[model samples]
Target: MPSEGEPHILAEIAERHARIGREQLALLRAIGRLDPEAPWVREGARDLPHLLAMRLGVSEWKARRWVAAARRLPELPGVAEALASGALSLDKVVELTRFATPRDEAGLIRWARHVSVWAIRRRGDLLERAPVREDRRAQRDRRAEWWFLQEERRFGLLAHLPAAEGAALAAAIERWAERVPAVPDEDGELPDLAARRADALVAMAQASLAAEDRADRPTVVVHTRLEPSGGPTPGAELERGPVLHPETARRLSCDARVQVVLEDGHGNALRVSPVRRFPPEWMLRQLRYRDRGCVFPGCGTTAFTVAHHLRHWSRGGPTELDNLALLCSFHHRLVHEDGWRLRRDGDVFAWLRPDGRPYRPGPPPPAPAGPPRPAPADRPRPALAAAAQARCAPGPAP
Candidate 1:
């Protein structure tokens, strides 16, 4: 970037790319028109946004935004001209026209040359509600609520509350937070208001959970498998989520009911007199103990796992432990639907990518701090120079 003559070249390249973007937007506008005109009907897409999303490999919201921007572009000659001349970007055009009127477009476009998207958004009273008339469906789809995941524990919550509900939650949080005096932390300082409110929320949730009986909770399904390969010990699987570490699955198994099925050497189901709908409780327990959890690598989920057959049952695979492995629902689907394969070794499942190459995980992280290994014993302390001292004291150089 600091090289001489680079400025001119970079600017020219940027201009060319921007011009290309302008032309691309124009073409996108043409495609946008066909969307409402039902051009994708034969393509089996449910609607224009669906078609665009599939074709562009983008989210529905993004596809809708681009389509809407394209539909509005014809009416925005000034925006079109500036875009064509590369004076502004498609993003700037979208934000500008999100609220600006034809009379204001010229000045806004000129002003936009100097400001950021957020700055332009803050400049409008109409921008907030402009899309209501232009595209009521898209505007209505946007929710006021928020959702977030706490990744450390793989817990997440989604909230799609309306204005009233949001306000109620806000008020309750504030009230509960104010009810308790801030406890002194290690630094002898009280937590801030936000932290206090967060704590109150957790307390509220715990109180609610405490009101319910544990027996009323739903059952968790865990799958366990022993790998034939000399990998890590057997692992746990969740049917719909990640795999669980073996230790975690074992800990959970202590309190949960279990059912297990055995696959024979071939991977076919063995017939029992009653057709044994579920595996024997004892067998399930043993499976859990042996495999620990889902054996699929890196899944990190312990509950709701399903036992899988390394060889498909329809293909005449046996119905005993040798042919069975534990898998989460997602990876299980990959095998059944996406052509990915998991070959079982002694204790490890060597995963294979759909393209037929082995799927190796990245390098393992460093081990945590633990007891240090023992070293050789220290030598006994040397005898104090007794002999030399004795010789010197005697004044005779022996």
Candidate 2:
């Protein structure tokens, strides 16, 4: 079926790909020759992987693989020769380097040429020898981190787990993903499997949070300015996280259990108020009974909803039923962080944008409303109460 020139074109493509592999081998040799300590130190990187990631604009994961392979190449001359001569692809070489020693590199090189990159990688994984020391190292290396890209206003997560635990977690996510319904785009095409997995992760988190007793839920504390300064307020800072935009702080405060810490301009604490950060269980039940779900014009999510204070508690607002509403996380952010506002006229609420235009004309008919089904009877609370008391017990003076 091939045209006369098709075979020639395909051969040329294969040759070019082989040339890329040779170039990669040269790069690895160059990396191996660099004084590993001096460059990373001068570049302010913790290790070769960090430096490579920053300089090459590669992912930390990829940088790590490259660094490991480069370190092994000098000892495995056969692998280096195969890659440099374009007999072995870079991907196959990288996987081989993971388990290859001087004695085994030649055999792996020959076997790798006949197999796919994934097969070689799987072989390397199975070849790994797990001794006690390696097990200890695995435990030591287990870590998870959250990194923020300030320019993109996004966060990235990286996690390294021991093989067994990682496999279990992956299985859980895959199973959850299977249960997640596919969401169609504007063109009616469903999201990809990866996106569905992300949705599954979020759903898992929601379920976990919902299972916790109200009194045992985690609290996030955001330190922010209530007093107006001469200039525009920059943003609110989290006690344990990065600085948050002002609007973000507002959105978080909507439903979060928060403590009010009053401080003077000089950063000296004036007082720490003991006001309840969130409504008591009884009050929350009343709120659910009243608002039913998110009060936003069209959003009616009932699960994982939070109580929003129409008049923020920090601004001398009372915590009475008249001042509270139920909102899901998304619409809550829309109001606090995204420049949307709500106006209450009797029992109805109106949505307004940052530019003061209405989201919909007048009061849209009330969102479909109903209280959540009654929960089971409460469990004994002594252990939880004790834990709370100990947690609130002031830490020893710094």
Candidate 3:
């Protein structure tokens, strides 16, 4: 057994190790924010974490986090130096980094040595909640208006709207929110009127844009049902509508049309059609359901994704359900035009490297909670099971 002195020495060493670890992390974070063109700085930033993780054989995520924390060091040079000299704890440096402004960050570090972490957090929150002056607020509003006009110039009318119209729309939305009943204090949760108004405004804008586009375009509704037939049963329900883009309408007119219907809560049809020619819509929907967002694993790019066919479309592969997958534009090109492979297995999808092994991806999110359980499993046993047993038994009282 170790003596008391031995245990004390071990504790001291462990504390020292933790202190060193924190300083190293702060340093790496500082480097990450540095200009990449600065060669010496770049070399240190790049090489340090790689070396640390390589030596420890830790996961890349942990290494990156450590480096990110380190990169904030330049914002708090005194804290960084103290950390390097083993004069301050790592926790203090982390608290200081939250204030990115150099002066504020330095002030935070100096204050941290004398105050509790809770006090620091409270002060930070208070600073964040401080109100802006009227002049500053007006300046900000003007700047936002100017930026909105600039966006209009860059992207044209589709992406831009006049400031007055936008403000009127916003006010109308707020009026709509004011009509919703406020929750009582007992309810413990109340609707955020501001957020509700914003959401309503966004939804209205999207619907308005979609309606406008549909009015100017030709649309053909195609009906689809799963039949006893081996493949999907597709039937056309054509109508004389506005003009559609030739390429888009042509895909619908094709013999190998992939028809699917998506509906709203009221059973009103949302989209009906011949799917995208490249990767069929059925496959894209399946990918969307399975992946929920971008299929790049850790990537959070949830914007529109392109359906990519693993096999080339020109090849013998039909644009059917099995041949399609959803990938963001970046990953789509990476798999098709560039050199990468994607494989699907049941509900799961995987990306593969050129070497033919699975390219490791992040784990899927946890499934949602299921419906409530019944009181007894056998209480409502199927009548069919009892009937079958009776038939198997010898003829009874007869």
Candidate 4:
């Protein structure tokens, strides 16, 4: 809210400027059809150019461009339609109509709708550079492109690779599919190998990105609102992306990112903790060694497990080895969103319902023959041993 007497002049001027410019263009187009350069003796105007120069106070070059745009409108009616509809500007059409003709106007108009003016110029350059006669073999070669559009939440990919390259890609995906097989403690029916490979590919990309030190690396950040008596609205948003549902954001946070950022409602950072959202690698390794698998008793799933908060961060939960447990995505969601809850005692954790009904899984099946014993800790120092022996030695005087 603005304080009393505060003016929103900048916003008001910006809005009005756009409307006036569009209206001027529309009027110019209407007059362009009527033929501006009539040798009218009325009102002592020499001609349309003179009238425009003197009345509108525009330079001859800019006025000429606008006049040319009006003249060329008929030849590129598609671009003209967009201009009239206020979807495109006159300057853009003036430049685009230079490369595009009536024959290509339809396509250019569509491009103008989705792409920027600079992109239109780029396409023009590409078209100019294209060979007049394309090689038949090269034309037949496949292409690869991927897009994830945000508006409709749509994803698309088109791949055109040489046979050997295709085979190598397929083989790589197959190796991971065979290695991972399926997600442990899967909630519903499992997807096929193709789907699993797709997921594995995304996971591989994410892991690589997290390890990358390059600028523009992506991150997941969630903003939660402060308590009722305090500041900003509680909401979650993907960095540089759309607002996300709280549950979806929480699920993504399970990626175990090395950093967690806490923010106020106004999107100001309050604190940053590298080990808050994710435990350090050492802690995760310790967790894996101790928990062995999902702690949901009989569920003993070892693969595709994630560390979950015993006391959720939303309720002021702490992030530590003692406050965390390993569980697969299914069980994790159950513990977080569903009515099920978990109680942890050091390495052990158990699941229960709101009704106090405990669900403990049975003991895990026996391991395959003769697993190697884990290596032991280092030997004690000689001086420490001597001290222990002295403490144990009987005091004869006593």
- C-alpha positional error of residue 123 in candidate 2 after TM-score superposition, expressed in Å: 1.5
1-398: candidate 3 lDDT, tens digit per residue? 88879988988876644444443543454457644344321111224443333333343334443554566665667767655554555544544555546656556556677886566545654665444573453343231111124655542112123345557866877876675455545677765766576556566677688887643213335433344443433332334444343323333433233444544444456666454344444665676665555465444233546555555443455666566665654455455434467777776677776566676633323332442223352243223222222222112110
Poorly placed runs, candidate 3 (over 4 Å): 1-69, 72-77, 81-106, 111-283, 345-398
lDDT of 4 by residue, 1-398 (tens): 88654567766654444443344455446547656667522312335553443334343234544565667776677776666455666556655765788887887777777876677656665665445353443344435545456798977555656556778877877776676657644577777766888877776677778997656323565555564467545456666567766655666665455345667656678876654436567878888777767676444445568877677665577767788788866566666555577887654666686456876433323332442232332322223222222222112100
Runs off by more than 4 Å, candidate 2 = 37-41, 131-159, 174-202, 212-398
TM-score of each: 0.41, 0.47, 0.40, 0.34
Q: Which segments of model 1 are wrong by more than 4 Å? A: 1-13, 37-46, 122-398
Off by over 4 Å in 4: 1-218, 226-228, 231-235, 240-251, 258-277, 313-318, 345-347, 354-356, 361-398
What's the true lDDT of residue 108 in model 1? 84
Ranking by TM-score: 2, 1, 3, 4
For candidate 4, the 10 contiguous residues with the lowest summed lDDT are 389-398
Worst lDDT window (10 residues) for model 1? 389-398
> Lowest-scoring 10 consecutive residues by lDDT in candidate 3?
389-398
Comparing 1 with 3 on TM-score, the higher-scoring candidate is 1
Position 179, candidate 2: lDDT: 94
Q: Which number leads on lDDT?
A: 2
